[model samples]
Target: MSDPQHSNGWRRFWHRGTWWKALLLVVGYWLVYQLIGLGTSALFHDVIDVADPLSSPASIFFGVALPILLSGLLLIVLAASLGWARGLFRRESLPGRRWMWLAVLLVLIPIVLRLIGTRWSAYAVATVLAILALGLCVGFAEELLTRGFVVNILRSGGYGERAVLVLSASYFAIMHAGNALQGQPLSTVLGTVVYTFGFGALMYLSLRVTGRLVWAILLHAATDPTTILATGGIDAHNAATAGTSGLIGVAGIFSFVYVAFALVAIFLVTNRTKVAPVAPATSD
Candidate 1:
C-alpha cells in the first residue's frame, strides 16, 4: 500500500497540470522581464533607449546583470517558499553524465572563430562579453522554468522524454524570434533555432547522464555568450538582407560543420564512456 503522504502529494501534483503551471511561470517571467526592461529604460533614459534593447546600455545592464542577480535570488526564494518536494528553482533531478568537454567545445568555438577571421574590436569585445553574460542569464531563466521545472513536472507525471524534449526545444527556439524583428533575418533566426535546439539536446543529454542542472546551466552560459561574440556588433543597419549574403556569408555552411561535429563528438563520447543514467531523485 502507498504511504498516505505520498498519495496526498501525488494528488496535489495531479491537481496542478504541468503545462498550465509552466505557461503561468512563463507568463510571470515575461511580465517581470517587461517590468525590468521598463524600469531600466526609465533609469537610464539619458544614456540608453528601450527601443533597441541590444544597443541600449540600460537594456544590457538589465539583461545581463539584473536577470542573473535579481532573478536568481527571486527564483531561489520562491523555490524555498514552495517547499522541498517542488525543489524550488533547483533541478533536483538531473539524469546524465558530466560532459565537461562539450562545454569546452562551445567556448572554444567562438575563440577559434576569432582566431580564423573575426577581429576583436574594442566595442565587439565589450559587446561580446556582455552578450555572453546575457546568454547565461537568459539560459538560467528559461532553462529553469522550461526544462528544469516544466520538464521534470511532466516527466514525473508520465510524459514521454521525446515529446517533452521536442515541446521544450521548440518553445525555446521560437522565443529567439524577438531578436529577428531587430534586424536578425530569417536565415539567422533559423541558424539560431538550430544551434539553440542543439544546445537543448545537449542539456537534455546532460540531464540524462548526470541528473543535475548545474552542468547544463554552466554549459548554457558558456555557449550562448560566445555566439554573440561570433556575431560581433549589434548593428542591424549593417546586417545583410534576406537575399544578400552578408559579411559572414559562411554562417550557413559553418553551422552545418558544427552540427556534424556535434554529432560525431556525441557518438565518440558516449561510446567511449559507459556513463549510467542517474535516477531523478538523486540526480540534482
Candidate 2:
C-alpha cells in the first residue's frame, strides 16, 4: 500500500479537511460501512435475519452489533492513518459553549426516564450484553467519524464554531441516509435523518461542554441500548415491545428536544476561546 502521509495522496487531502474533502470522506465512509454490512450479513446469513434484526436478542447481536463492531474497527484504522488518534481524543481547541449542557440534558432526561420504565428481564442476559456492546460500538464509530475526524478537520481549516456544529451535525444526519438502501420505509428513513440531525448537534455539544470526545462517545453509546431496550425497537420498528406505564410514556416528549435544540443551537453556540491552546497532532 502507498504511504498515507504522502502530501498528494487521498489521506493527506482528508487531513486538510476542506468542506468538499469532508464531504468526500463522508461518502467514502458510507460506502465502506455499507460494504462491510453486506459482507457481514452474508457471512452470518445462516444466523441473522436482516428483515428484522431486532427480532430477537441473538439476531441483534449477530446482525446489528457485529457489523457495527467491524465498522468501528475500520474507523479506528482511519483515525490512525490520518494521524488524528491523539488530538481527536483531547480537549477541544476551541472553547465550549456552557449553555449546550441544556441540549445534552434534554437528550439525557429521556434515556434516564426510559431506563426507569424498561423491563430489564424482558431481554435475555446475552442480549443485553450484546446491546451494550452495540451501543459502545455505535458511539465510537459515529462520534469518531463526525465529531472526532470531521470536527478536527474543520477546526484545522479555521472554520468558526457555529459552522463546525452545523456541518458536523449535518454530516451525522446524512450518515443515516443509508437506511433507505436496507429496505427501511422512506418515512422511517426521513424521520431518522431529522432525529439524528438533532441528536448529532447535541453530541457535538456534548464534546464541547465536556471538552473531550470521550463524553460524546459515552453519551452516544448510552443512547442506543436505552432506545432499543426501552422501545424494544431497532431503527423505526419494534417487535417484542413491552408495555410501559410511568414516566416512560412521557419520554417521547423529550425526544422532540433534539430537533428543537438543533434548530436553536446554531444561533446560540459560540467559542469562548478562553482556554490556552494545546498543540494538535498533525494539524488535527
Best by TM-score: 2
Q: lDDT values of the candidates?
A: 0.52, 0.77
Give TM per candidate.
0.64, 0.89
Candidate 1 backbone overlaps, count: 15
Worst 10 residues of 1 by lDDT: 275-284
Error of 2 at 129 (Å): 1.1
lDDT of 2 at 57: 66
CA displacement after TM-score superposition, residue 146 of candidate 1 (Å): 2.2
| CA RMSD of each candidate after superposition | 6.8, 3.4
**Runs in model 2 lying further than 4 Å from the true structure:** 1-11, 237-239, 243-246, 271-284
Task: Kindly report which residue pairs in candidate 2 clash with one another.
Answer: none
Tens digits of per-residue lDDT, candidate 2, 1-284, equal 44445643655666555677666777788898778878887888887876767666677767887777787788787766666667678777665667878867887898888788887878877778878888998998888888887777776566777888898999888989988987889998998898899999899888888889999999999998888888877774254564375666687776577888788988887743233222223443
Q: Write the per-residue lDDT of candidate 1 for residues 1-284, one digit (tens) a residue.
A: 54332445633453344655555555566567656766765666665544655564445766445645566556555444333234423443434445634544553454344334443452444555666677677667766655665565455445455655555555555555555655668887777777666556556555555455665677666655444444543323233212123334444354555455445545544322222211123211
